[model samples]
Target chain A: MTDQNGPQLTRIQQRNRERILEGALTAFSANGFRGATIDQIAEEAGLSKPNVLYYFGSKDEIHKTLLTALLDLWLAPMLSLDPDGEPLDEVLRYVSTKLDMSRDFPRESRLFAYEVLQGAPHLSEILGGRLRDLVDETVAVLTGWIDEGRLAKVDPHHLIFSIWALTQHYADFEVQVRAVLGPGHDPYAEAQVFLENLFRRMLAT
Target chain B: MTDQNGPQLTRIQQRNRERILEGALTAFSANGFRGATIDQIAEEAGLSKPNVLYYFGSKDEIHKTLLTALLDLWLAPMLSLDPDGEPLDEVLRYVSTKLDMSRDFPRESRLFAYEVLQGAPHLSEILGGRLRDLVDETVAVLTGWIDEGRLAKVDPHHLIFSIWALTQHYADFEVQVRAVLGPGHDPYAEAQVFLENLFRRMLAT
Candidate 1:
């Protein structure tokens, strides 16, 4: 079977591919998939359009590759939700990891935000397949915790949605957050404490 | 003082302006402000480019007008949070109203989402001024509730943030929600119940 991770490449190929993706992310995140052009991406990458095309077949291909890589990294914390571990702790840890991702990778967060806001036309398949699988697995674990009386009973899907909404709000709505918070206000630090308290209150049996 | 809303128009001009705004919402919501063009909006509105320009001075004006109108409606629920009302009930009512807005005005929600995700270049002033003012007023009422032991104590700002995050998620990330919930799943109905339970639990004394 072909690897979902992508085919093997030489170090030079990998480096060039990384450069192209970096540029594409900037373009796509700023202008979105339709507004962004291959020429703009090549200029951002400091490569010729032909050279960029040599590494990735088309704009769609580059976007798919970037999305695949991003979703993998983005979903890592959720995927690591250990069924055998303390349920609330696993959930809280996932929250912290996701908050950190938003802080560290705001561009990636915006890229995904842009895609989803545009109805996720490009991501429906992956969302339906890979994302759904991961969520279903994690939801089963959360439901098991509730059944065992280890956590408060809540809709597993909505609980996960709450976590995502709360954490990603900081990144996806950064402008609104900052504007409302005013100058010099640190939102993420406040968010961490607030979210910890929120989930504790939300999940404690 | 010059009207921030718009100049007065004849009835026909007013009807045409409304049509333009409706079409602009669809175009801007679909492609974001930068990606969308006046020509596309004109075509969407079934107006000539010159006719579209006659109603609104420029593309920025159309976007600004749309955003201005949207924020007014968007903030209405928050503005209605009654200081004299039962605290938890007021909060839950606001939640329900916001969720209803999301379901009924998904395009408006996505338009705002697209702007905020791109750093709210057009909305920073309004967010800082009107939104912050309204939020501050609402927070004072919530703080009063907490002080009176009418509601569980929480960071008022983050509490507001949580409400916005959860309700707007149904609109902004609808594709992801629908994909995971599978075919024929009704997210908003389920979300209304889930959010009510969530806030009740979090806010219970």
Candidate 2:
């Protein structure tokens, strides 16, 4: 999708952009940004190198585009935490939404993980600025709930960290998880049940 | 350290080997296996390229050596989860030890994270075999605790996953954590307090 000030991309152009971003997600997630080449991304996208370049100026641009979009998706669950909603219920809803995103968007989750793992060079500002502001708001919300005895008292920042860690593990560490658990188990479904119980037991007064 | 069956190397040989592995950890942790080269690892280790190869046959050998050591350290926490100890205390100790590892051995943590995130190509056998077996034993120990009314009723596997996800997050996502928290916070110390409370609350019968 074009920015409001930009001219509209043609339908085909939009599709190609989406395809490039999708393939770039695969490439970048599997290989760190430095390791992934433009040729590899184009190959993964089923497009020629020049074709990929024609759509995005360079690998960095493609990466920036993906990271920008991913940051928004990454923030959605935290952004949706309703201060007006029941405290425990709202937190659970946030956890559930994040877990669903991990299941539905494992590539995106790994992309975020990879970026952050490489020192978040592309994301440091957003991590400190946009993401921080939202977490600050969330911290306030959780603190208020805890102070009111509407939820069990816990450090708000660490609580947020815990949620991120628990949900993203399924996506970022799927191999170890699968290897450890062996075959024939539904990880996401089981994780949902386990996490819900764990959170409820942790947060319930 | 030399293999028990092998003749011991000189002290200088052992130190150089440790240097190479340490440097390899930094390189591999920052840039996944595909991205890191032996030259880069040599540079990180402060040794010449030929000097580096003199100790290890190749980059793959160096990476393998680092991971083999990492997996042992990784398993140390879980392996020490004593079956005969107080169930709650044993679980809490496991959490504390793991969190300590995340604090003290962050690079090792990220090195393992990178390997797993990249599908554990070199580690599939060990993951599916040794690590899985260790987790199986851990699951049995946890099940025994819960069944004996010594611990809360919870899925042993997911419980172990939670311990992993929660503790490892502090290390694997250190950049994001620091960015969001800003300056002046001793993250590991704060994490320890929060996680101790979290597990305590969640595990109390």
Candidate 3:
């Protein structure tokens, strides 16, 4: 069995893998890891259960792949936080970009939110290693901005947490947001203006 | 089978009921609703499974009771948003109370967070009805403050959302918070000062 599965994938393998992942994200995002089933993923992907298992050894493997892919997409904005750029403008841009992602790609946002809510059991390694490293670098960059008088001195970790909380609120709490904001109100538009003004005022020297 | 349940017991019934709920909260918070079981709750409460079921008809009933109780406790501070009080102060006090709850009643907070993270399937009725109504009233009060020139004109709903996001981050993301903040940092004290400055700056007339 091990020897049979040793080699790299062909184009058919790549296509089937993509199909399975697309379906898995939807199921996992909506039902959570424990609540989701491989059969459901198979049906959603329009593939047989064995076929699904053929691409990935188990549900755990598929989940890890999805999470790793999401981590990259989710971390893109933070990775773009330029240490040399104008501080306040850079922060505002980050906030706006994050809010945009929340609006445009709510499923991916919710998937990340779900994993983190579950104490990130599957992604603990990623959180402990990759996420921790990224955050440390960002905090160091933020501390430099503060020391240079380019930004107000605040706890860099908490500042990042606040930014995350505010931006992800629109996506993670969409039901509440939509209900309270009413059907007609555009939350993203208001969120953009509110966040820009908020970060600008909060970080003003 | 229906008659087997019989009438409720005297003092013992109430006492055991409370014990069951307390134990369930710990289990449910730690393992989530799906991951938890009556056996674990029974073991935690020092009662057998049948004895636990005697008080609550099913695991779902126990979970519902805990959720209902938590909703009341969770909404207490928001309920105290006196329309006649100073707007920013009322809001600040509300924020502080929530932060305190996040610290003191973290398990309860996590239980609620877990529910919402799972799409709030079990509690959506209460969330959509009672919780929604309470937020509406709270938003009206904030809007009144804005209209009266008592606070900076801002989107009241988003304002409330921001307060919730900022405060709950301490508890809901406790692992991440500690990991990033380091081993010795006191998140609550720093959060209090940071939040005070944040709201003060945002709401300053």
Candidate 4:
């Protein structure tokens, strides 16, 4: 657990850290925070458990690291919701971006999903503070749009929730979705069009 | 596990069964299926482990019973999405019903959420077969409404997913939701109006 380098990880150290995080994500995503183990993550990362601990200190540390990293990525789309852009277009683009992340980074999505499912026990502080603050700011931006007559009058908070729920459905329920849609169906394509139409209609004055 | 009463449970038997299932639901919802234990459910139900097993044979059996019961209740609203009724009104009713379930039966909702989160490992057959079959039938009803120009054209599958995600969001993310909405905010009332507007707009031709 000693940081001999003291705040300066070497290039190789950075690579190893990334490797450990990547493996931890996969393990944690599959088995969840409570179900996943240090051994499994270490094995997945192709490192000894002691070496994994050497870099991350403990299981909780690794989980917290992955969670913080995932939160940053997950909130990026919402953070990009442009106040100056066309309201419906901005909302639709945000939905599209979230769906794309679901497809591209399902593990991260599931890991976040699992954490939230367990009542956000591990990340309650982050949820209450950082996440809530960001949502409040975004809601203000959305309210501004509605006031400017760029978007239909709607509860901005619920609108954001709708966007989040619809986009994340494809990733979180991929197994059931794939089964029902059949192998030929493209959920992302269908989702993009469906969400655009949904928000457009919802926001149309 | 034997039905000595022949074709129906006695009042006492039914009482015990309900107690066990309710306790199991609470434990499973909190800790998840794999994380839960029969002994814990037994203790929660205030019955000996052997007595709990007497009603439900095994942990798998207890889980299956709870899940099957939940599936029935969960699908009741969707099943009632009447082709005979006005399209938008019917869908709105369904949305409200689902949101109400999330508020009143959050433990049941969370149990199912956990099961689906874990890939529905034990209920894949139910999800893939019975669940998909029901969705197909519901999709046909929606398609008929669209074909008749009673509702706006949209992908039925994605529409179903949207309904599910929005309604279930209150239960699955209750912690974050409650925190963000503040202690006094009524999520159900807000959800009811929000969903009504959301689906109404989405389905309006």
Using TM-score as the measure, the top candidate is: 2
lDDT, model 2 = 0.89
Pairs in steric clash, model 3: none
Which residue ranges in model 1 land beyond 4 Å of their true spot? A1-8, B1-7
Best by DockQ: 2
Kindly list the per-residue Cα lDDT of model 4 for residues B38-113, writing each as its tens digit. 9999998989999998988899999998888777888888899888998988999889999999999999888887
| Backbone atom clashes (below 3 Å) for every candidate | 0, 0, 0, 0
- Residue-level lDDT tens digits of model 4 in A5-82: 367988988888988999999988887887888999999999999999999988999998888877777898989988
Model 3 segments more than 4 A misplaced: A1-7, B1-9
How high is the DockQ of candidate 1?
Answer: 0.75
Output the better candidate (1/3) by lDDT. 1
Q: Which tens-of-lDDT digit does each residue in B82-113 have in candidate 2?
A: 78899989998999999999998888888989
Docking class of 1: medium
Candidate 2 C-alpha error for residue B40, in Å: 1.8
Ten contiguous residues with the weakest lDDT in model 2 chain A: A1-10
At residue B66, what lDDT does model 3 achieve? 88
Candidate 3 or 4, higher lDDT?
Answer: 4
In angstroms, the error of model 2 at B176 is: 0.8
Superior candidate under TM-score, 1 versus 3: 1
Candidate 3: tens digits of C-alpha lDDT, residues A27-74:
887767777899999998999999999989999999988988777788
> Tens-digit lDDT track for model 2 on A61-171?
999989997777778888888889999999999999999999999889999898888888889899999889989999999999999999998999999999999999999
Let me know the TM-score candidate 1 reaches against the reference structure.
0.94
For candidate 4, the docking band is medium
